[model samples]
Target: MKAVGFHEHGPLDNYDLLDVPTPEVGDGEVLVDVKASALNYMDLFAVRELDNYVPQYPFWGGGDVAGVVTECGDDVTAWAEGDRVVAVPFLSCGDCRFCVRGQEMLCEDFTMMGEMRRGGHAEYVAMPEENLIPIPDDADFVTAAAVPVAGGTAWRALVPRAKVQSTEDVLIVGATGGVGTYAVQICKNVLNVDTLYATTSSQEKAEFLRDLGADHVIDYTEERFDEAIWKLTDKQGVDVCYNNVGGDTWVQSMRTLRWGGRLVTSGATVGPNPETEIRQIFMRQLDIVGSSGANSYELAELYDYVWSGDVEPVIDDTFPIEEYMTAFERMDNRGLYGKIVLTQE
Candidate 1:
């Protein structure tokens, strides 16, 4: 199998396209012939080994996978050969307390695929049967590959974790990124927010966000988005803020919310430590909630929405395995409006 990986974590230049041994299915596992895979910002962190997250030597990381089952291991009765599926990124011990309660993302022994072991960046991958979800027959590999992490995370943050109401006003920070695009769609089309606002870097990106259902777009590069939101809402502020970017944006996102409003976060690509405004938080009775990946039930809901066309994955570009470097570069530069997919041709 031709795999894209790094021998030791260092930098993007360390990644190489190597001919590696194909993974074999184990007991209760399934061997998937990877048709398409999608990249996330975590892939960049995994490659650099940030925050002491060390992968096994010769590591490959790709979170979202859409493929076909080529073989099933012993005791894997739920799936068989020739089944089309999407692999859930988070893997949990099914016996854990959180998993038993259907909160698998909070399991004590939870870990994500592509972070701890070989991932779908290769031609084939062997994952536990429990990690596979049968996608709709009409779903294409590229679209299915885009949902597991990006769409699932957004769904978890906005729908279940935040419990956003249709009458509420919402703001999506970094609204043109992978998770942000889905956040906009869910807020506008599914959750049906009263008003949807999003922040991006450029006018072009702002326009892209508008098309994704943002009622208002603010170019953060030009002005402070919190002030923009305040002005737009006539100083009432939004009822909910979906904030994934951390650092300075954390304080800003909180400031954009109205009294009793909630802020939910999943990713922290833009530096985690932020000088929080405790005075404003207490005075306004704000709620700050941290979320991670979605559980099996949440992923099922997201898949159904996608299959019904109520939600769609935005693809910025697609590349073959050989051009993986270009795909990484595009994501690293923040030049894309949606997910970047890689095919295993």
Candidate 2:
């Protein structure tokens, strides 16, 4: 099987496309013939972060996969050969307290598929039967692949974690990427927010966000979005602020939220250790909620949204599986307005 992986953690250059041994399907697992895989910021992060990601050397990292089941394990009964599926790539010990309560993302033993082991940036992947979600038979693999991590993150952040109300006004910082675009869609199309605001680096991306249902688009390159949002709201902040770009934007993101409004986040792609203004959180009586991968139930919900056309994955581009390195390079530049998918030829 052809896969992309790194034998050691270092630069993006370390990621090599090679023909490695195909993964074996153990009991309770299924081997998927990966039709498509979506790239996320975490895929690139795992390439550089040496401390707390990946279980071993020669690790491959891709969390979003959509494909057909080619083989099933002896203990697997829920899925079989030729089942069309999308993977819930984050894994947790099912016996844990959190897992039993359906809060698997909070399990102490929680680990991501790509981060913990080899992932779907390959021709084939073997995952536990329980980790797969069934998509509609007609669902295209590229779009389904785009939904798992990016769409799932946005859904988990906005719907379950934040519990955003329909009438609320929203500001989504860095709303051009996969999660951002989905957040915009959910805020507008699903939640029906009174006002939906988003930030991007350029007017082109701002227009793209507008088409995705953002009511107001702020070009961060030309203006400070926090100030712009405050002015737009007439000095009153928004009811909610969703931020995944965590750097200097942390302070501004908090400022854009109304008193007692929530600030939800799933990632800090900008930089994790952000300079803080604790006062914005405490003095303002703001609620800061953190979210991670989509739980199985949430992924299922996202599939329904995509299947029903209530929301759609924003696919920026597609590349052949052999061009994984090229896709990673494009992602590293942060030039895309949505996800870049890798498809099997």
Candidate 3:
């Protein structure tokens, strides 16, 4: 099997395709012939081994994948060979306390694909049968591959983490990236949020956000988006603010929220250590919630929306497995409107 990996995590220069042994299926696991996989900021961080986080050398590093099952291990009755599927990125011990309560994302053994274990960056990968979610026959493999991490994550942040309400006015920061595109659609089509505000760096990206159902798209590059959002809501800020871009934006993101409003976060792409305004947080009775990627239950529900076309995956570009370096380059430099996918064929 050919896979995109690093001999030892260091920098982008260390990443490339290497001839590696295909993963074998284990009991309750399935061997998948990977068709397409999506890249994320986590890929860049993984390749760089930021803070010495890579668990081992020659690490496989892809999270979002859509593929066909070529073989199924014993005890796997729900899936079989030739089944088109997408797996939840996070692997958790199913018997744990959190898993029993349907909060597998909080499991003590929680680990993401491409981080602590072999991921779907290759022609073949193996995953637990429980993690597999069926992809509709008509769905594009590349698009389906883009869902597990980005879309599932958006579902987690909105439905469980933030508990976003239908009557709430929501604001999504970085509203043109992979998660942002899905976030906008989830808010509009699924959550029934009528007034959606988004922030993007370019006018073109802003237009894309509008097409995704953002009611107001502010150009963050030109002005402070908090002020724009403040005025857009007639002095009453949004009921919920979804912020993943950490940095200076953290403190400002709170200003976009109304009194007692909630701010939900998933990732910190810009930088993690953002100075907080504790006084404003206390005075406004704000809730700052941190959420990780979705659990299997959330992924299942999210995929229902995907199959229904309510939540769609937006692909920025597709690169062959061998050309993953180019894909990584695109992800490193911002400005993409959606996901960057890698194809095995």
Candidate 4:
């Protein structure tokens, strides 16, 4: 099997294409012929072994995959060969307390597919049958690959954790990236939020966010986003703040929230820091909620929206499987609007 992976931690240039043995199916597993895979910032972080996190040598790196099942282990009954499928990226121990309560994202043994184990960056992958979700026959593999991680994650963070309601004002930070783009659309279209504020670093992205349903777009490079958000909301502050960016933005996000409002966070791409103000928390009585990746049920609901054309996956670029370096370059340069796909061909 042909695959792209890295043997040592460094940069995207360290990745290489090579011939590796195909993974074998285990009991309750399904073997998929990977057609497409999507890239995320986590992929780059894993490759560099940043934050003392180390992936196995020659590590395969892709979590979101859409492919056709070629084989299924004996114990698997939910799906069979030749079925098209998308999968939930998180792998958790079923017996854990969190798993039993349907909060698998909180499991002590929780690990992402591409981060902690072999992922779908190759021609084939053998995953637990429980992770597989069938994709409609008409769905494009590239688009399907784009959904599992980013789209599903946005759905869980904004819709469920934040509990965004109709006619409420919402502010989304980093509104042009994969998760941010999904957040902007879902809040505007699905939740029917009255006013949507989004932040972007560039004028083009600000315009793009407006097209995606943001009622107000702030160019952070040109002005302070918190001040702009306050002005947009008439000094009352937004009802909810969807923040994935960390560092300074995290602290500002709390300030942007109205009294008794919620701040939902998924990832901190800007790196972590201790910047939260205790005064704001106690004075405003704000809710600080943390969210991770989505579960199978959330993935199913997100897929339904995708299938119905209510939400669309944004594809920045597509690279052949062997061109992992190029894909990572695009990701590192922040030159993409959404996902960078690697096609198995």
What tens-digit string does per-residue lDDT give for candidate 1 at 56-77? 6677888899899999999999
| Full-model lDDT for every candidate | 0.89, 0.89, 0.89, 0.87
Model 4 regions more than 4 Å off: 50-55
lDDT of 4 by residue, 1-345 (tens): 977787888767778886899999999999999999999888888877653544456787789988999999988999988999987888889889989988888898888888888788889999999998988878889999999889988999987788899979999999889999899879977888988999999988888888888988999889988888788778999999999878788888888989999989898887767478988988999999888899888888888888998888888899998778888888899867988999986
lDDT of 2 by residue, 1-345 (tens): 888888877899998997789999999999999999999888888888844767776788889999999999898999979999999988888888888988999998987878777799998999989899987877899989998888889999999999999889999999988889889888888889999999999988888888888889999899999999889999999998999989999988988988898999889998899988898888999999999888888888878878999998889899998888899999999998789999996
Model 3 regions lying over 4 Å from their true place: none
CA RMSD (A), model 1: 1.2
My TM-score estimates for the predictions, one after another, are: 0.97, 0.98, 0.97, 0.97
- In model 1, the worst 10-residue window by lDDT is 49-58
Between candidates 2 and 4, the one scoring higher on TM-score is 2
